[model samples]
Target: MGILDQNIDYDRPVKLADGVFWVGFADLEGRLQCNPYLIVDGDEAILIDGGSRPDFSTVMRKVLQTGVSPRQISHLIYQHYDPDLCGSIPNLESLIDSAELKIISHADNNPFIRHYSVNSPLLCIDRLERKLTMRSGRTLRFFRTPYAHSAGSFITYDETSGILFTSDLFGSAGAFSNWRLFADFDKKCLGCEVAHPERPDEHCKETASPCPWSGMHHFHRKVMPGNRQLRHAMKVVKAIGATMAAPQHGSILYRVEDIAAAIERLQRMDDIGIDGIADAASCPA
Candidate 1:
């Protein structure tokens, strides 16, 4: 079924790969949607960026729909310390109730993540050699994308499924009214003509047109620190050679071509984060 099919039930766990599931709450009215992913390998499961406190029940319900109990979750990987990603830590710990459960993240973020009163032992990925090997022999690699949006930002690449869980690096900000789960760009969009009809000769990296690029541009310009940091993160993304990219918010880039297009667009684009602030520096004192 198509990812944007309205008939498709969003309440249930949507399988992205063999054992990978999107167990997030589809808040259709929210402008910024959060996506929590579940990677089940054998009997053990890993939850990535579980949503906020208010989203706990819905996210938990979808997690349960995957036939994996909360107890089966062996780790919760928080890419950063954002509340939208790990605010439900206490609630999740209460449910999982397993002493073996670990909250995996970069050491830089542990201090901030602890503010949520997470009881599970924080497993610093940097100390663990930047990788997690499941009992089933599935290895997940972590790459630090520092200052992409946070000091401790990182991306998780599942070697088994070739899916990169890019925290906020490739995230978009599309309103739920016309939200799509996947970045399925049309033929005209791929040609860049649709994105820049008036200036077809220009190398159109982004546009005001209605497409995934518009949302991506809007998000990166607002959240990313600068072009240098964005390029640094994009380099890691390219080096990983992930077949698909699942971000914390917005649509998933399921197509390899779409993923490549996104990387290319982000690389050439400029004026992000602080640089995008036009009149802030001139504000009257």
Candidate 2:
């Protein structure tokens, strides 16, 4: 699937909101980054998505060091079932108290969860039907845009801070480390842009092109959304005023500009019908 490209040192937490932190994996290149959130409110904490494959323990250790014990994590929310994002669920559950952890997933994720980890708890939500609220005063509203990235794929919106813990929706390339916190991201990302990119085969001739990122298929590919669904996701996100997108990979984009731009681009492309089970091709940098 995906190689262990870069290893991010979980030295300290990168604060995304007052009670939230970016606790996922980072890449040296600018192509993709996974930014799972560690949110602490009152005495309890919640992990949005388990980090990448290699860094699960580090993520667990970092979460425990918050003075909140392993049993303190109230919830483990899965935006979707992509292995890059949710691969650590089985391992994490073994280390922590599963009884205390309520795993959250969209309603359509039940069957997949049964196939992957039958013992794990799955809390599904119908994006078109209702919203789920966390005890920390954060309201998680879902938007079902299946096949946008994955069949059961959905986007979760946090109403409290205008943040969307989007799984794979609006991601960029590059990994942000401790030395390059959110503050220095602008400068660090500039250097990363030259060295690290989403895809490089674009520069090669059509026949000569090779897929360096074909490995990305282990996760989910970037499938173009239908005109109707694209417009709907765009309108909903803009209406919600999503200030920052905590994607499953890469550094967080502060504004909705990039996501908005992608929506516009998708609309211009030839309209494609949803197959419910199709893969999105390699994402461009």
Candidate 3:
């Protein structure tokens, strides 16, 4: 995939299926953007991850366009507590009555809400035993994947559409418009680096530090940590045939078969000494 670093046009309500849609935010040169999903069914709606503070305006407008009231948003699922994933919660709640907002996140992430997620309504599910079915029939089954990309993290799979809303696991760079399946982007030569005028290649390097969105500190202390978790996640996703991978940042993938292939290739690289620890800054949202 050829990497195109250009300003992206923010679009609303890109239909993914019968009840699933993507609300996107633009970044420099089509490289970074916030990806928030609106899962709607009749009178109920669930926002997978709230966008950045600035993107909430677009999100609110989009939600209203669906003819659903602000109070109709029944759930806010935070795949992780990253700022890009849940930063706009406080802002969003201020506009809408979040009294009914059910904040669902990994159990390990509940405590990180020093101020952002503290007072709002929430449901933190730390363990996964059975599949969770949303009112829209979107089934979510999670696999415990500690420290795959973040500590106390888990990747969720939707059984109904076979979509995996993986939070930062095996993520890459691409603007909202250029995003396609993993294979499509890779074949087109798109890497994670989004070009900026002052520092075009600055986001390429990988480093270890605290997570900016959640103030979560991280270190490379585990032995083969990312690889181990990635391998296990691949097996879990493969068993369920996950077709699309929707992350907090960049692209709503529709290439399931290619995603499986990418998993294998990533594993093989791990065996060859390609450490999975990425520079946190390289994570564009």
Candidate 4:
């Protein structure tokens, strides 16, 4: 059966791969939902982009459901300094209560992340050669995607699972009514028709539809700085050859085709960030 046909319990941790779990809270009422992923390799656990303070209880509950204790989480990897990702660092540290626990992030984000009153040692990804090796010999490589959304923004690629934990690069915002963990698309959606045959150069902008591309397009234009930064980030994603993409704020792109389509759409997207402002300013009031 397809993933949508499966009976998924959102309250419990959803397994994405052998040791990777989606520990995010699925809040249907929220416009933007945060996705926090947990990677348990042997006895070592890593939390990627742990959600905000208000989401701690729900996020923690899901994490615990994965059969991994808070203490098992040796590293909390923050892709950026956004509060949606790093706001609960102090809370997590308090629960884990271990000096060995480290908060891993880019050096550019460390200074801002420290404002959370984090007790764990802040380890710069650059200092670690941009890779983290788990006890089971599994590796996670970090790729910097600056200006995609934040100056220190980066993505984590799990070598074992080939899952890319993208921060905000592939995030979407308008799927609340029909929210699903995995991307769902119509047969004629932009994702399916990569060439845009029916619409002919006009990209999908209907956010209410099941088309993941529409929501993704709407999100990138608002969050990412510009098309240049987004294109640069897409290049990194293409080079990584990730089989799946799990973003911090949207449905996970599990299929290879969906991942590729999302990357292409972003690469071609225009009127983002400053360009968007410039376009709006040029329009007659």
Candidate 5:
């Protein structure tokens, strides 16, 4: 994912599924982009990744645009400790006027989120019950995947939607400023007809490809430690069999084929260590 060429489609929030919406934004100062998901269930609303601290206003507005108030947010799930992944959490606690707010993450990440999750008790999934059943009967399964980018990194799989919220595991570089949502993109990939062939990748020969391999490759190499850790994580991702994958970075991925392509590509790629700066740059959208 090279610098995401700005597009008008990502200027507003878009619904990804029945009760799920993808609210991604570009950081004006950093020029990087991050995606946060809003999951609404009966009497419970889960928000995945709250953008960076500086991005709280924009992120919250997008969340509210989904007709979701802070009071409705019950759980805040963190995929990892990256500023882009869980940075806005501090602001969210102050912004949300809720009383029963609960934070969820891998047990190892408690220390990292302890600062902002003061008001709410953190329920570390790998430490406690693995499955969380919401009031809506929608269940989420959590997997402990450490050392991809951080030791407390983890992934959450939503059984209800067959979508897995992978923190940094399946992320690609660049923001999806000029991209389509999962359902539409999935249909194109599955049918071998890409809506726009302009995506930055030549890996897939599909016409007008939807696969963002170029970005994915750049991201994984720079972040992940090595193939060992990544391969172990990929096994878990493949076993989960997520039909749609939502990463803290990059576009929302739909369709098993496209998802598999990412997994396979990462599995075969080399790793980079503590790179000076990420291939993605902060630029105006």
Candidate 6:
């Protein structure tokens, strides 16, 4: 939860890569900016992580602005439900006219997704083989990082763009203003020095006492249990040859060293035994 220090075009989709767009919505204060990605190739399209129930109209409006018809989206890849991920399933199913709108996710997501609508067919990803090739010549390799945040948490890697769509790992706060088609590794390396952010409480109240962003520290702790899962996730994403890492909540990471540094930072967090679980009052933000 970071509130900004710069300007951003929050009403529309922001391009993150060739054929890849960030089509998520945010509150006016830019605090609850849950991110979703749209990947398009010719007439075929894929959507990753639809925003929450309240975000349906804005998300769809921004997405439709990109010229992708609902029928063209043959695949819906939800990272996890948790309101922020698959809350728009009901709307998407109604809006998209494709009979082939196949869903791909962990089996644990079946109940949550079907709760919205029983019509969206789900295809579970294989952990061993770990890859799904779409009819449009795009291959999505899956990584089952169970319990990293959610029991069914997993990630996808796009072989074409060399981009890894990790659900929550390596996420940072205050992404709306800092977003770019590519990661600004140099500026991110300096952390909150680039932008003087205020905590969500102070930000909402329009108060002072501005603080420095801990760089995914709060998110990792709140969403993830601890280092045991993080270590395994690090190993899963380690050395994947990903040119950029797109997460659900943070700005995408785009440089080799930047990605590596993020891994190392998580490694250090684990070593220090830091935690961010909401109920754990002992853990500091």
Question: RMSDs, each prediction?
Answer: 4.4, 8.6, 8.9, 4.2, 7.9, 6.2
> Local distance difference test, per candidate?
0.85, 0.57, 0.57, 0.84, 0.70, 0.71
**Residues 1-285 of candidate 3: C-alpha lDDT, one tens digit per residue:** 222232323454555555666665545455455677777777787777777777788887777766767787777777667777777888777766766666777667777743584567556564435346677566777766666655656667766656677666555442334344222344322222222222222322233211111100111112225556666765665666677877665445567544655555444444211343455437666
What is the per-residue lDDT of model 2 for residues 176-267, given as tens digits with 9 covering 90 to 100?
A: 22213232122222212121123522322322322212212212223434545545555655666687766676435564554454445434
Candidate achieving higher lDDT, 1 or 3: 1
lDDT of 4 by residue, 135-252 (tens): 8889999999998888888999999999999999888867476678888655456445333322222434554355566567777878888878999999999999999999998789
Model 5 C-alpha lDDT per residue in residues 1-285, reported as the tens digit of each score: 211232435556666667877777754333545788888886568888867877778778888887888888988888776667677776888877567888888777778777655567788886657778888788888887778877888888888878898878766654344444442343334333221223444445553443565556667777787667888889889998888888876666766787887677666654444332355235344
Q: Could you tell me which 10 consecutive residues in candidate 3 have the lowest summed lDDT? A: 210-219
* Weakest ten-residue segment in model 6 by summed lDDT: 203-212
Report the Cα lDDT for residue 166, model 2: 68
Q: What is the lDDT of candidate 3?
A: 0.57
Task: Give one digit per residue, the lDDT tens place, for model 6 in 38-66.
Answer: 98888888899877778889888888999
TM-score of each: 0.90, 0.69, 0.71, 0.90, 0.79, 0.79
Global lDDT of model 2? 0.57
Runs in model 5 deviating more than 4 A are: 1-9, 26-30, 174-211, 272-285
At residue 204, candidate 2 shows an lDDT of: 23
Q: Which stretch of 10 consecutive residues in model 1 shows the poorest summed lDDT? A: 193-202
lDDT, residue 1, candidate 5:
23
